[model samples]
Target: MQEIVGYPLDNFSLNLRDIVDLIYFEGPLLTLFENEYGDSYLYYWCDVDEQCNRWLVFRVTRKTLRFYVTQKLSLRELIVNPVDGFLYSIELDDELQCQRCCLIQPPNLPPKYIPAVDSYYDFSKLDPEETEAKGLLLEKIWDEKHELSDLLTKLFDKPPLEMIDEPSLA
Candidate 1:
């Protein structure tokens, strides 16, 4: 599997160690899908605490992943925009460290929903076993390692447009 450089955990209050623990040990990937532009969106179920369990979706661009793999960016720089959710952008200083991050609120959204945390799945009341089982099943179908590598290979190595000549007119 290709090495992963960064994760989109900047919006959260987690430190590097906590982020790694959450990703590798605690969180279970729920699903993954690619957009027409070859960008990958991954959803993960995180058991943040005894009282809080939520879902997070990350939008990782091909360029961003490339930058991450090359060590040009840190995991905190990855943008975690949940599906049909809030948007956030991060700025980095010359030292390649995060400078400032802001939530890009949509104008149509109400002020009460500025952060829009409600869009994500909150499984605080659900049974963990069932949720995790479903998550594992999803992981099996859209295996992150294989899917990501395939998408990255296509994005980086394949031609942007396929040219097929039209059949000769009779």
Candidate 2:
């Protein structure tokens, strides 16, 4: 299956050490996160470069999963408007060190809705030195990943595969 553009990746070529060097989260925090949130469909990954400009986020709830990519700007607030109405943002300094990280949860939304993404480009094709590696077209990526086709089908309200399949004609 094709990969989703701007979606947090479960499987990637980069190792945890390489990935950790790029993002703010440490082993302890990551472990705590898994405990707080169930591990099924967990999304996590970052750009494999010195300046880790982005991160993929995902939270799987008892009911559903939410995903999006949060941006990291130089000396700027990490989160502007959260899609899930809640977030955990880590701001990095110019030296690629964490300045501050915070968990922003509004009273209006429940605890379940969380946030996650990867870039739109194919990592292998992009130049290591080039920063504007916003690779593939969004529409093409979306369609290729089956995101547009399977999103609605993935909603928890839909019946399970066993029920959907036709009974064999004996």
Candidate 3:
């Protein structure tokens, strides 16, 4: 027998920092989100999946990312969908230096169920530049550190992965 590994991560490499960043983004998501409620005294990292889609959420506030997704909603569907309904996005505006979040429903879901969810990123504790830099550095490292894109493609055909629901995953 050969050395046993937890999972076949041969396709890519993941560092501790990467894990931390992901936790900082997705902790709230895993747990039921109350948006404006709860205390965010802690920070963490979340491990996504084979495709490596990472996300970050806060306890004190709510922030969503439109472009930053690990594996999309398809993967989540395979596991579960406990959301109240539909989906939304949490995005940030660097030029203005602020944080905001919003949740809406999918086109297939009733438009009445979704709201106009939008806001800037929360950077009250750390400088926007500092926070942004750290996340960006991690992102850059992950993006170029390894051929993750190609690896994911190899694992799941481009079509199946692309068709996956995203909001459900986050």
Candidate 4:
């Protein structure tokens, strides 16, 4: 196993919570399927189009990764947040607390463990445990999100305001 003395700024650290939100599974995405019920699973594409949000609809199939990004969303913002995504949402045991599952260097490292100054990374691939962990983290974050309802309003096929009514004339 490759030790982390120093790693690149863009390295993936995964732990199994299976939190990713799959899009292909929702209804046969890309040209892969036409079924309305073919839900996207762990193995799907992350489509990135200029006219779409900078989101990833990723999947791992036969040990190969396939991803597509949206053209509509700014590519830079994707590293932080995307309408759809591939990320980790760390879960605190406390019901009200929130933490992000991250791979970045720990703030306080022991004297023995030298933080790698040189850029290094393992691009070989992610193992099963890692995949499951990231997905789980994303799922947890999705559950605890504070603005889900409002975001959904914007995502709906109908306009955000059309589905609601004016305040009752009480």
RMSD of 2: 15.4
List the candidates ranked by TM-score, beginning with the highest: 1, 2, 4, 3
Compare candidates 1 and 4 on lDDT and give the better one.
1
TM-score of each: 0.28, 0.23, 0.20, 0.21
Query: Using lDDT as the measure, which candidate wins?
Result: 1
Off by over 4 Å in 2: 1-85, 106-134, 137-140, 144-170
Candidate 1, TM-score vs. the true structure? Answer: 0.28
- lDDT per residue as tens, model 3, 1-170: 11111222222111112222322332232322221323221121122333332222222211122122323222233112323342322222333111322333333323222222332222222233454443442343344423445433433345234434478654
User: What lDDT tens digits, residue by residue, belong to model 4 across residues 35-103?
Assistant: 133222231222322332111122222111122211222222332232233322222323413232223
What does the lDDT read for residue 59 in candidate 2?
34
Number of the candidate with higher TM-score, 3 or 4: 4
TM-score for candidate 2, please give it: 0.23
Which model scores highest in TM-score?
1
Cα lDDT, model 4, residue 76? 26
Candidate 1 global CA lDDT score: 0.38
Residues forming the 10-long window of minimal summed lDDT in candidate 3: 11-20
lDDT of 1 by residue, 16-94 (tens): 2111111223334333445454455543442232333333345655555444434455443442323334443333334
Q: Candidate 4: where are CA atoms >4 Å away?
A: 1-15, 23-146, 158-166
